[model samples]
Target: MASYHRVLEVFDRSVQDKTLECAYDLDPWDILIDDERWTGKIRLFGFVDIFFLICYSGEERFEKGIIIYKDNDSVRIILERARKNTTEYVVNRDALENEEIPKSYFSFEDDKGGLNYQILGLGHPIGLSTNYDPGSLKQYKIKIRRSDDLVTRKRMQRGLKQHTLIDLMLDVVRLGIITSAELISKVVTMTVAGSATDDLARKYLQVLSGGQPGTPGLSRDRM
Candidate 1:
């Protein structure tokens, strides 16, 4: 398991100016780790450290989903991950059939604790064909609102059980954890480990590419 102390230590050394702009207090660390409500929630996700409780202030302004990672050159990168996965949205034709869509929240739970991320923005509808049920009718993915939203649909079948790979990729991009250009480069280019590649950079890339790293790969237990 990756210790919180070790993560904070890395964060302390990585910051160029030793200051992270946040909506919290002058010392965001104190409020984040010291407070019981926020303790253990802030953790290493993918190649970056996700401060779930803190709203980050970046090039834009205050944004939700703050992630701290390393740049391609191994510099500390801090940015906000957005709630909506993509801007391209398709209108739902089945308005009468669809129920009220509540907000989406991803809960990361493990032995230590749980962090609930309240997904921002009104969700945009997109279709992903599934292998389990392959057909024209299965081409369109079920709407993902709240977990309960699926309870009433399709004879009260299962709801959104997991986040898709595309969803995770968009998350990092939207949050500014990794830029589109950076993402593209990582995907196309072959990465060599050790002195040749940035470990943190590789971790985020690995995560977006749907591979789990040895250390703190979005697993709460590892965190």
Candidate 2:
């Protein structure tokens, strides 16, 4: 499994000064995820932040955090953990000229019939390409599978786990019974617990898990 840090990096870049400042900021701009069909202004329906509580060992670690962006039609997932930067970071280059550096990815389905979609980043920094090479930005495509619901095409599986988390968090928000943080803490703390070498990570996890140092750590079942 890929490290969540890569996903976080994409989101951190996407939310720069030009990008979304908060969930409400998502509606002002029409996101083009390599698609020309769904051009209408998309609204932010859901947003979730997954932190060190869900992190596990033996996976790539990132520093910042992870976030989920759910719009009117689709959801974008990005994660962050602790890891080294060995790969080239995409910058102010023409996205069309450069191949898409898919650092991290996630997908979502609407309530109706669960239409599957694979969203690709058209520009660097995940989002906030308004000032960047808009003309040169890569085309964001939504790969649609009408018949299949849970089954996804190639490279679509990595996003499955993230999507599940997004769905759960969205439901929690809808229910208004518990906050996403409390719910994740209770669920993850019960399933996994380990050590965090990073000072900040440990402290952050402790806060989420109610100041329990060993409450939250990293562990992916398959990885």
Candidate 2 TM-score to native: 0.20
Judged by lDDT against the true structure, how good is candidate 1?
0.26
Q: Which lDDT tens digits does candidate 1 get at residues 1-223?
A: 2332233333332223212222222223322321223322222122222221222233323222223221222211101111112212112334324556312222222212222212221111111101111011111121111122332322111111223436445655766766887876654453332342334433331212112332211211111
Q: What does candidate 1 score on TM?
A: 0.20
The lDDT of each candidate is 0.26, 0.29
What residue runs in model 1 are displaced by over 4 Å at the alpha carbon?
A: 1-7, 10-23, 26-48, 52-183, 189-198, 201-223
What TM-score, computed on C-alpha atoms, does each candidate reach? 0.20, 0.20
| Winning model by lDDT | 2
How well does candidate 2 score on lDDT at residue 121? 29
C-alpha lDDT of candidate 2 relative to the true structure: 0.29
Give model 1's clash tally.
Answer: 3
